[model samples]
Target: MNHWLTAPILIPLLGGILQVFMGYAPISLRRTLAIATTVLTLVSTIVLLVLASDDAYRLYAFGNWQPPFGIVLVLDRLAALMLVLTAVLALFCHLFAIGGTDEGNRQFHSLFLFQLLGLNIAFLTGDLFNLFVAFEVLLIASYGLLMHGGGRARTVPGLHYVVLNLVGSAVFLIAVGMIYSVTGTLNMADLAQKIPTVTGENLSIVKAGGMMLLVVFALKAALIPLCFWLPKAYARATAPVAALFAVMTKVGVYAILRVFMLIFGNDAGTLANLGMDWLFPLALITLTMGVIGALGADNLKTLVAWQVIISVGTLLAPIALGSTAGISAALFYLLSSTWTVGGLFLVADMVAQQRGSAKDKIVTAPRMRNRTFLSVLFLLGAVAAAGLPPLSGFFAKLLILQSAMAGPQMAWLWSVILIGGFFTLIAYSRAGSIVFWRTVDGHIEEPKPLGGNVSTAAGALIALSVVMVVLAGPISEYTDATAAQLQNPDGYLNILNTPMVGEDG
Candidate 1:
């Protein structure tokens, strides 16, 4: 067993447990522990990424049991990429939280680490049952984090979030049971091998199960009709919690990519490409709705929350294409949008803090103390979020457009994405002008002082967008390779059929 394969999951679990015991300790000590653990997880995930670059599938099975019979964690380029992304986002958010947000609850660090633990498990698990388990873990942790500040604003949205996820969880279990009844296996690789052989009534059941799974993932991804819970829930959370929740949607997207492309892929005979037809149209509609929401939003945090849906729509449209190029483009855009939006959430919070009672509303207020600095950060985020040139978003969207050139829905994809971006640009411009440029011409109110830790945290995340642009060549190549790896399911499926080294078959 590769012990490192478990590091991402274990580190966070251990950290959260330790944090629970340290509930009475000084906040500084708890913060130190959480940051140290996250940094360690980041290093481990980066190492895994380098190891996975060799294009080999490594599995860590529990209790000496092989896949299809034991719980396992699978490592590949895609999982590694997600792990690193989560850790990076969590580190910055944790830094910002310690600056003051942690004061909201004594167990804040504990809940935060547990949330990371859940996200890491969702990415690394090798079977459908464990995936469901991962969802519950994260959702439970998120329940506490979302309600950390404990006000009616967080309470109402948090209630909706909890209830919706509970429904999703039930649906997820039913779908898993249905699939298991038909295939006698829940391991992803085992299902991939067996799904092709299912026929008649069993095949129909499997198909229904697959569609049910799509519904659950769609809800998690906050796609269209199921997305209404996101804007309010996200906008009401404390900044650090909201920023971390940015990657929560991607977990659903990742599941779609892993399950659909591997189990119900082209080789699945009667069930091949099971949900692709529905995914494409829904993705486009989600994009349109997201931009519309942004246009109508009256608060900065709400606008950023809407942008998350926009990013989701942007990501899934490419992914729904199910081509190597399309998947690659989506991966690049995923990194760009996740970091950018996470930064924007932090920036929104900072701006709201300085505005006193106005608190992130779009209406004009006295000019802020750090007006120039905050405006610049907000501008950089706006440029990237709007897909303007010389930033990661521009390149990511360009790649998506290029990938769609040969698809049947090329025109639809092109029109929706480009127009969505245009509207996004206008929305941000309106907010920016009202908040930063059109401030009241009078003595500035006693704005709160910005903390170095929070400012650095937000700035670093936005700066990554510039770094992504600079490293686009190698990053694109990596995503391209990951996409190729995803397309070849044989590499993933062979894990169950192959024998472990130096062990009996």
Candidate 2:
């Protein structure tokens, strides 16, 4: 298992190939194959994670050249944490994909595996160009997944999805080229070292490169001005597709946190030298606008999409705070929100599908009287997203506010955070008020026949939600570790890009 270092990349690569081939097989066999391959990929990733967690942060040069001279896969606290999150989300999506899967869909397995592969690669790579390659892998897979079996449903937004991401890919390439031109290397740790030594004309070039790079990551993260593509595209997708859609934007957000912290934290980094003065107001407005959008949206699925945007903006507050505790809070919030927002979307889809669609209006059949599931789902979702106490999200926000409040002269932005939380409360309140209270003729009605294994997918989501409550302690510790690791960059750079005997000479 020397490839264990490369297993994260190779697992999905093989699984994706299997999926594409299986897509041409009989429907029953195809689905069974998809599930098995995905689950195997999950197992592969978990084994890798468990093995890596016990070891020092390390690197594997793909072609045997060391450090700055070779393309490498690096494992450290942050990358490992993202790998775990992606796997958890991917597992749930596959579970939900089972029954929600459309008939005659040509390449469900192929696209799903490829998407997962891209995410894992993005998480594992220690190089910037490789990061861009991974992003494109994800983009292309997502394009196919978002539109598959969507028919007329995906056409309009699918157009935006394709054209917009293609443009993003182009801009991303240009950014990579700019960085390589200036640094003469695309390895992340090497760039972190060279970025400080970089001088003269490249200073402005580096700044422009950083800004353009941020633009690319932000577009994917759905940060405010660049967030237009998110809701429309996600809202138009099928349920399982939407579930997977939640994981995709997060990769972009993760990139911003990873790249910015490593390169900028190295020396007078991007956010530090800039004091977040570069775009604090814009991020604040993004937070406000996302909350407002959630307030106005009527559809359950679309509302969930807006909430994802809200979480991304709330996440920006701490990056602006630029303190250890502030980033610790952001890490906590990121972990909880990713779980909550993604789980909520999948559950909403289940309810919507049972009730006929995701419309604001309730319309389940009189015989389909199982309001219990909806009640449980909405209660947890509202409590989770709104940051109610006794839940992980609440603890995260509390930690963030503590840091933001204590930071030097960030009170204005901190107040915006408090207001942002209130707006989120209101938005979640509006959704819950209608969803849990609206009278249907069969509010207490019995569960209607769901045709397949409803308990499998729904049960898994419910279990994950419940675990968020029970596992808060250990999860918080892990988040703290990741946050602290981001604050101190030497461990990551030292491990991955530091030259050994033959390489540096």
Highest TM-score model number = 1
TM-score of 2: 0.91
Mark the regions of model 2 whose C-alpha exceeds 4 Å error after superposition. 51-55, 266-275, 357-368, 405-410, 440-448, 451-454, 496-505
Off by over 4 Å in 1: 443-445, 501-505
Cα lDDT of model 1 by residue, 1-505, tens digit? 6889999999999999999999999888998998999899899899999989999988888776877888988999999999989999999999999899999588999999999999999999999999999999999999999999998999999999999999999999999999999999999999999999998899899999999999999999999889999999999999999999999999999999999999999998999999899999999999999999999999999999999999999999989988899999999999999999999999999999888777899999877878899999999999999999999999999999999855469999999999999999999999999998887766556777899999999999999999999999999999999999999988898778656557866
RMSD of 2: 3.1
Q: For model 2, what is the alpha-carbon lDDT of residue 25?
A: 74
Candidate 2 least-lDDT 10 residues: 360-369
TM per prediction: 0.98, 0.91
Candidate 2, 1-505: lDDT as tens digits: 1366676677778877876766667777767776776677667677766665653566777667777776788887677777777777777777667664656576787788888888988988888888998988988988888887767868888898889888888888888898898889888888788888777888777777777888888888887688887887887787677877776777877887778878765474433333255445666778788888888876777778887888887787676556777777777787778777777776676566545432433322332234586667767776778878777778878887787654454676667767877888887777666665654564333333443444455546545645766877776776677677777777777755445545652
lDDT per model vs. reference: 0.94, 0.73
The 10-residue segment of model 1 with minimum total lDDT is 496-505
RMSD for all candidates, in order, please: 1.1, 3.1
- Count backbone clashes in candidate 1: 0
